[model samples]
Target: MIVKCIDNNNCSTLTLDKEYPVIAEAPEYYVIFDDKNQETTCKKTRFTIIEDDYFTQKAKATITELNYQLENEFKDIKQFTIRKNSKGEIKEISVKFKYY
Candidate 1:
């Protein structure tokens, strides 16, 4: 199977017997299949995984909600971090506040 990292424009060809890392910084990508021997006349097909869409949308919503809550309830916040799991799922959010 061949996987293309849509955001980074990177491609990797993998065998069926080995494990691969599907999660990445930019989770958007397409899986492509192409025959190398018939380069001139071969047909290629690509597939998009919807998990990228779901995770991105969920992360955006979580970020927006956190920002709003922090702005209103924690005015001293100086920085924040959005944590994600191995599957690229949002796990936890941490914030640092300034003390005066």
Candidate 2:
């Protein structure tokens, strides 16, 4: 999993790459920065599993975390072949802003 900060107009993006089947989760406040650290204001952020493509011999479990977890029960790498994992696979989950 890789984390990044997007400094364009108060927005940031995070990217995660897993070799095995895993649940990708992000915290409600995924992108956080203290006002004291910087002169800019921080806004509320949200994350979601916009896309899911996990196939195994058994049923999968629900992902309910602010972080990513890998499931190696099947150990089969062929299932993910159709879906290529690369820099291009990154997806934007959400955008944040202040109410006022």
Instruction: Say which candidate scores most in lDDT.
Output: 1
Clashes of 2: 0
State the lDDT of candidate 2 residue by residue for 1-100, as single tens digits.
Answer: 2223333343332222211112233343333232223322322232233234443212243232112223543332223223334766744333222233
Candidate 2 lDDT score relative to the true structure: 0.29
Lowest lDDT 10-residue stretch of candidate 2: 14-23
RMSD of 1: 12.0
Q: Could you tell me which residue pairs clash in candidate 1? A: none
Query: What CA root-mean-square deviation does each model show from the true structure?
Result: 12.0, 16.8
Off by over 4 Å in 2: 10-28, 38-100
**Candidate lDDT (C-alpha), each:** 0.47, 0.29
| lDDT over C-alpha atoms for residue 1 of model 2 | 24
Best-performing candidate as measured by TM-score: 1
